[model samples]
Target chain A: MTDTIAIGTADRKDAKTGTVAANRALAGPRVNGKAVVMTLYLVFLMLPIYWLVNMSLKTNTEITSGLTLWPRQITFDNYIRIFTDQSWYSGYINSLTYVVINTVLSISFALPAAYAFSRYRFLGDKHLFFWLLTNRMAPPAVFALPFFNLYSAIGLFDTPWAVALAHCLFNIPLAVWILEGFMSGVPREIDETAAIDGYSFPRFFVKIFMPLIASGIGVAAFFCFMFSWVELLLARTLTTVNAKPIAATMTRTISASGMDWGMLAAAGVLTIVPGALVIWFVRNYIAKGFALGRV
Target chain B: MTKTLNNKAWFLVLPVFAIVAFSAVLPLMTVVNYSVQDTFGNNQFFWNGIGWFQELLDPSKELGGRFFEALWRTLLFSAIILAIEIPLGILVALSMPREGWTVALCLVLMALPLLIPWNVVGTIWQVFARGDIGLLGWVVNHLGIDYNYTGDALDAWATIIVMDVWHWTSLVALLCYAGLKSIPDAYYQAARIDGASRWAVFRTIQLPKMRRVLLIAVLLRFMDSFMIYTEPFVLTGGGPGNATTFLSIDLVKLALGQFDLGKAAALSLVYNLIILAICWVFYTVMTNVDADRERVEA
Candidate 1:
């Protein structure tokens, strides 16, 4: 996939304006058609999220009273309850702690490996890369029991580090793959140039190469954080108390009594905020990241 | 760019190897150990050998029957998801604004669903599709159709599929959009010079250009859908009589719910094998296509 994108980019090595003018020409005749299609699609995308947000702002009685497109009587009790409660708020903190750790660990581990894979031909490199991907493909259900027993035995069962470490099985491979794609795009001459100038390997990597692929690092970090933040099963399995993610806390809302619809909606909204903020900050990075290219 | 022969790159890769091994290898070894053994609690065990594997493979047996049923359902779900999502995503991508602040606005909105945790996705759908209060359920029932997702198997299946599409189609669209953006406009200009029809331009230019990212989208969606658990488990609880129970949900039920470690471990191995086999097929097909493209270009 990266290869194909690279081919496309290589074809565009000519001046940028030539392509931009051609694109404008191509898109000109279909403006009306494009607008309608985009409008309809965005509405579909926004509707369910709107419904969830609507539910969160209303009282439980209003929610059960009838179906309405918008909240008739707004209330802040649900959001207030989540904010004031220890268990509810702490779930978010615990989740953030592990997700941050996992993203850092995964990206840091992947950097040098990606550099190696991109720049050098090591023995078993292909096999090792394929092996890493297989871990990503492995279902967490398969590892639930073993992970439980293993973490417990190691006395790291309920800590944030446990979930962070477990997530590396999948996230590290992904990080490595993305970073490798970006690194391969950098001309090998740059590394040779740095070395010829008497720069040490680590020094050269940190100072010269890192900034060159900073966008790639941003993309890789975004993905690592996204996957770790959203994953529920492994995170839930690895932690019971100290590191219980907000997703697990949402499940507790379904007690023997009944579901707490309003509270769950509120908590769900809060969980989405951090990701939305991250996406906003890295919105452009995400498009290039989705390219899976070294843009 | 010829890479130097640098076996010493192993040192650069060692940290990744250590961390991944500690997480992946140790737990996998545990799974392998349990698959071959049996126990009746209290740290006692018996060597079961191939007993569980034999039982799991025999369709006449209970565990075997459930496993195969769940496996078929999972494959069907992935097929349906891919069939609907890929073309729909491309259509949406084609319509997306190519410039201005609207592009940023569209990108963030399209990405909104992807960032929400999977369980919350299920919860939103479960409530959204409920006949009692869900807008989807209320609207459907008001339209005079017998639609009860909780009580009806078909509704349960439809709701789950729709929920999945709603949650994930954005991923495909975003990848396709990125691919589209990468295509040099010179291709389109050349097509226009040749008096190519819109369809002709799409078939010869856009589709081929999007192939690589499309492959990534397909593979990601397939693997994720095939192993789908948390969403369905939360929404349907694998019910309406196991209508929505995919392989992961079944494996979790066996491993955690019933505490049948031996059978569950065997099932897990079989499950992993199936995913690996499918992924290998995808990888080979993609490599062949890439090679073919290169050959033509040469």
Candidate 2:
């Protein structure tokens, strides 16, 4: 597990090869096997999304008349409908507003705790960390009733803040865990160095360490936003009709009138678009976030 | 210095901690309170002791109701999910290339489904499984399978299972792929010198190293699958007559749809205990296995 071949093999890829070898040469295949593998994965990954996107562009009649691999004459109607329709736009705003608020709250709370756990051994560090993770593991359905009662009694039910707060339970733990892992990689010496130079801890965290792991914090917040944005159970339970997300709106696809296939497909496509954009940018941060050091 | 928390660090994390604690503790306390109490419509509650627990656990009591049935279904669901997803994810990861933009691209694509919301996944499947109009359903039907998730139990189960596999197996593959990437060429070289077969190298070397992340993968997938609600709920509404109903769906039905708060609270507490117990056991076993691996290495 030690950092084997730390100096040579890694550098070889960057400097050597006057002839400019194939990209797959690094992994032992001449045809760039990684690209092939990645292409195959992209196909697997994009197929359903592609189907949803195609479905979204079509009219309802075209949608339910048995699936076509491609859309028959495209229409902007579904997308246009989502925007022009008051109910759809409100749900979209509801989901977006709360997701933003909750992500901010999660990172703000998690950063200090993660820094504390990473740096200082407090009175109940292990227990507190473990306790935080328990929330991460707790099923939302298990708490749905209590949340309804509690939020309703407090007059918070049906508010965006209710879902925002409920999501904070899981997202905060995740944010803390990811941030802690990132912070731990920074040596205590760095903190000592900053403070020895007369920098305050807050100043030090904000100015010194912040930039060092900006990617990590950004990564954690992206996840926070992602989870809260897509979350349905607690969000759905907490909000009745007024502040529901697009998820709840999509549920109305099923009615006595039968399924609204085109609209549902459009909604599904819209949801995936935001996530796709974030993941496209942060894909590298994700893999590095998954591991460090040698095997 | 290590002993001093300085109180100031708490300020840095206060935003997240306050939000999490507010959401977590009160609802939990409410559940605990109701698990031992009876409540009328007026919000007046009376101590019911462990009466709910006894009824929930008693086999002779059909009062076990759909709770027991949902639990059994969840167990089966979790089992099927693990069996299908783990191998499939491993294969997908193994088939992936080891380096360059290709590796990066694959990672991004694999992560796409994981990033999407769970309910949206259900919606996608819901539309996709329409025999009359959905792409998946139409294709399968074109191939001569009935495949209606809304009407048939088996089709409902199959569609949901396939949707889940499509959704989550990517996560396991990514984690495993990360694990594989971390392995230095030296160990693989040692196996090569020893002339070990690929399966032997995988089992004796790869699987052993992967044990840690594999534990994490299993625990995460199990918890998620057991707690699953939105996807199946969206797809089937726990229907074709309760075939796809799990604990979460039933809890939602009782608490929200039926407005039975007291029973919902009690049921929620039981549900939490099951997750807590399973998580504890899994964590313990994982830690012990890690310890065992350390000893063997020594």
Give me the candidate number with maximum DockQ: 1
lDDT of 1 by residue, A1-295 (tens): 4434533453353224355444443444567788998898889878888889999998888888888788888999999999999999999999999999999999899999999998999999878888888888889999889999999998999999989999998999999989998998899999999999999999999999999999999999999999999999999999988889998998877792677889888988998999899999999877779866632
Write candidate 2's Cα lDDT for A138-240 as tens digits.
9988877778888898998999888888888898998888888688767778888998999997799899999987978988887898889878888887898
Q: What is the DockQ of the complex in model 1? A: 0.45
Tens digits of per-residue lDDT for model 1, B1-298: 5689899999999999998898888988888888999989887879999999999999899889988899899999999999999999999888888678999999999999999999999998988898987888988999999999889999999999989988999999999898888888777666755545557777888898888889989999999998999999989999989888899999999899988888999999989888888888887787687667658867
TM-score (0 to 1) for chain A, all models?
A: 0.89, 0.85
List the candidate 1 regions with Cα displacement exceeding 4 Å: A1-29, B288-298
**Which predicted model would earn the best lDDT?**
1
Please name the candidate that would achieve the greatest TM-score relative to the true structure: 1
Q: Go through the candidates in order and give each one's DockQ.
A: 0.45, 0.39
Measured against the true structure, the TM-scores of the candidates, in listed sequence, are: 0.94, 0.87
Where does the lowest 10-residue lDDT sum fall in candidate 2 chain B? B1-10
In each prediction, how many residue pairs overlap at the backbone (N, C-alpha, C within less than 3 A)? 0, 1
DockQ class, candidate 2: acceptable
Error of 1 at A167 (Å): 0.6
Predicted complex 2: DockQ: 0.39
